[model samples]
Target chain A: MNNELRIMQNIYYDNSATTKVDPKVLKAMLPYLENEFGNSGSVHSFGQRALAAVDEARDKVANFFGSEAQEIIFTSGATESNNLAIRGVVDNAIKGGQKVHIITSKIEHPAVLEVFKYLEKNNLVETDYVEVDENGVIKLDQLEKKIKENTVLVSIMYANNEVGSVQPIESVKKILKQVQNDRGEKGLPLYFHVDAVQAVNHLDCNVDMLGADLLSLSGHKIYGPKGIGALYVRKGVKLAPIVFGGHQEYNIRTGTLNVPGIVGLGVAIELVAKEKGPSKLKEKLVAELKNISDIKFNGDLENQLPNIINISFLNAEGESILMMLDMEGIAISTGSACSSGSLEPSHVLTAMGIKPQWSHGCIRISLGRFNSEAEVEPFITALKTTIEKLRKMAP
Target chain B: MKYTKKLLEHFQSPHNQGKIKNADGVGEVGNIKCGDIMKLYLKVGKNKKGDDIIKDIKFETLGCAAAIGATSMLTDLAKGKTFDEALNISKDDIVKALGGVPPIKHHCSVLAQDALKKAIASYKTRNS
Candidate 1:
């Protein structure tokens, strides 16, 4: 009886890492996973039923982005989607005998940054990284200056995963519009791609409205099943296939389709579309946290996603705080070098001009749709106690 | 890397935390850039055999779980021992007492050993 009383209730605030799969989405995917299972490519009644489900999912995903069904290409996840969008376009440009110069922001997820680095190292393309401001937003002037006449593609994330800063996609669209017109006069091709994995939950994602030639999103990040994602390739944007197999996903990505995952992704996107505005719990938590001394918040709070709150506690190391919280049945993430395999802290914080000492003390608390207001007070109480304990132990 | 159950217990309720007021000797090692800093305090006095002994020891640390656990274990090993015996306490001893830390955290035990040596040296320097 005493042991049962000592058990702490679990509270999860790591939604930005991944969300719990919704029960409705799982219900929608059950038929496809069980008796309705069939290879979408086979020629029979079972195959036709499976193919119809895939087509329905495709249409739902396409409708979410205001694109045609043929434009959406399913992949494993956002990493694959990002790889497909970037490598596919750049490889096509290279095959056309053009010297490719591509641009990406310094604060992009490694999926995009590492791909650019690989291309640059191999001499396949000339790459430039546009800088971000102190709030982790991309600098528009720097982006414009980095674009040379030979630049063929630019990739930027819709929202940063670590700090939750939302980039100014509208301003970026305007700049690209001007460049596109200039390049069009010379019959040159330039494309814009966005990694929208973190933005679909809270932001507008209509492909034409964002003026993106290609866009990437992951199912897991939006409360759908894992191992499924999609890429929005605009009509007339040519891309070479990176993975070779049976002709699937219009030859851009190949393999047997993940029918259940696809069905879940479609239902997840539709559900998030009806989700309400900014979370009041997040606002309350931030406001309460501000009452504590020696705490600094990262990123532009006004423009950031409603779910994420990144903060650094002076003198208290992040990994220590994270472990303490974990003991209390609360889950969070940290940017401390000690927590990661590599000794360096978060690249996003470093790119935003934060010092290593401050970056090592950073922790991220992200709320999800299923999280309730009742969980906030307990979390804050636990956090305050943990910080006090750590502060007392520190030199 | 995962910490052992023994290490987590030490981190959760560390031994002899905070400073000893007007300590006989104090030693601080590591730096903020490395993401760990350990400050050790010692109270040295003569034993019945007329040999210098550590009467009390405490530590304050700003680091991850391994750093704090290593320091806590070091204090437990060094207290009530003569200065020479305390100085002989190795990194392996502290690591062994706490089961073991991750390979990447082996430096934390090294830091603990260095802190003990520095404290003993400081006591000798003031008396000599």
Candidate 2:
């Protein structure tokens, strides 16, 4: 058994942070670089070919999200997508002579929450954090109570990256529909923005079911290249450009198109759609880990995205467990992808009303397609041994 | 990955585990929230030959396996050593006892050393 364990090397389990680029995605991207290098904006045969590549990628992305090809605005990833969505709405609302207000959740990824925090601090917008339950689902009554006549936008996630909790976006859309009918307003409809970075391939995503006016997704989160993402701006949902430059992504994002990146993202989305996604490893891992004593799952396991598990070992520190796991060649995360490398306990846990002691003991294990049940046994055995040893060491 | 033979020995069939209920000295270190806490109990002093060696050393730890393994190995390292000499044990020596820990958990072995210092300090304070 020991000899078999020695044969293993580099057990990469921290897929939620990022994934190794798929070979197919890489193959699609290669031509745009070394060989087919040309600025998409230049007006020659080379440039026109590059421009065609960009359009092809855009159409694939639009098909992936059930949106029009023109609606997909390329940006630097989910962070930029979120910034563009929030700032765009605020800039447009302020210009329309309305006091802009925003409603978000306590468990929002920092990309969305931090921007709202900055707005609230600067008095640029009135912001309200609709509280989430232990599973990190926003309370509909609380959301309704916070919404005012001036609420220009409501930002939420299609799925949380840390705990994999899927939000009831259809329910949120229903509430928004009721609010719109009560107010008798047609023009300047309330902006619904969904950060679907983690949901692109794992779940069946459609702009209609999400009922979002704007959707943000990153390429790297779904086996595509990093540093590139798309923002879905529904037609007639007018938002001023937050990033200034020459009209590149239809005057919405003003920069030369990242041709290789777009191609990779398109390939990733197409493969997932064609293959119908094979991420059952997440459920298998979670089911096995659930059998352990003193282990608590952090989110709504039933309705989760089937790719993440946030677990806490009683009387065990996450870093200590992580170090030992690293020794065993099994990789894992502490909590949020954005908060990696920071020693602070997860704010997501704190928001769920988890005790501070429990927060420090938390470990986030996200599964990817590359993982298999054959690889999971050693992880469980290693985790159990590490936890038992740590418990005995504590005073 | 297989733990080194020494680490597994310390982890599986560890020596000097549990607490000495009437311990002559006790050393406790690390904050509760950090999740690594170690308490060392020592029963030290002379034999009929006036030897100053430590008679018995016991530990109760609440932390990860490596920490427990280190704590377990630390006691074995200190046991039977001359009372004053045992106080001189360093983190390097403890890591050496377990065939070395992964770099990140070097602090756990270090904590065990600090705990030994604390236990020795308490013994001196009580006897004086």
Best by TM-score: 1
lDDT of 1 by residue, A1-395 (tens): 14357558589999999999999999999999999999998889998899999999999999999999999999999999999989998999899677889999999999999999999999999999999999999999999999998888999899999999999887898999999887676566789999999999999999988989999999999999999999999999999999999998988899999999999999999999888898798889999999878988999899899899999998888999999999889999998877877667788998999887688678999989889999988888999998999999999
CA displacement after TM-score superposition, residue A242 of candidate 1 (Å): 1.8
Off by over 4 Å in 1: A1-7, A96-98, B47-50
Task: Give the docking tier of candidate 2.
Answer: acceptable
**What is candidate 2's DockQ?**
0.30
Q: Give the top-scoring candidate (lDDT).
A: 1
Q: Looking at model 1, give its docking quality level.
A: medium
Error of 1 at A71 (Å): 0.9
Cα lDDT tens digits for candidate 2, A1-395: 35465644467878888988999999999999977788899999898898889889999999988989999998989999999999888888888566788998888889999999888888889999988889877788899888888888999998888888888888889888877777776644688999998887688788987899999989898888999998999998878898788978778789888989998988888877786555667777877888888878898888887778889877776766776677677899774211233434576777777776677678888877677778878888888887887676555
Candidate 1 clashes: the total is: 0
Q: Please, what are the lDDT tens digits per residue for candidate 2 over residues B85-122?
A: 78677888888878877665667787887888888788
Per-residue error (Å), model 2, residue B63: 5.3
Model 2: residues >4 Å from true position, as ranges?
A1-5, A96-98, A186-188, A277-280, A336-343, B1-22, B29-36, B42-128
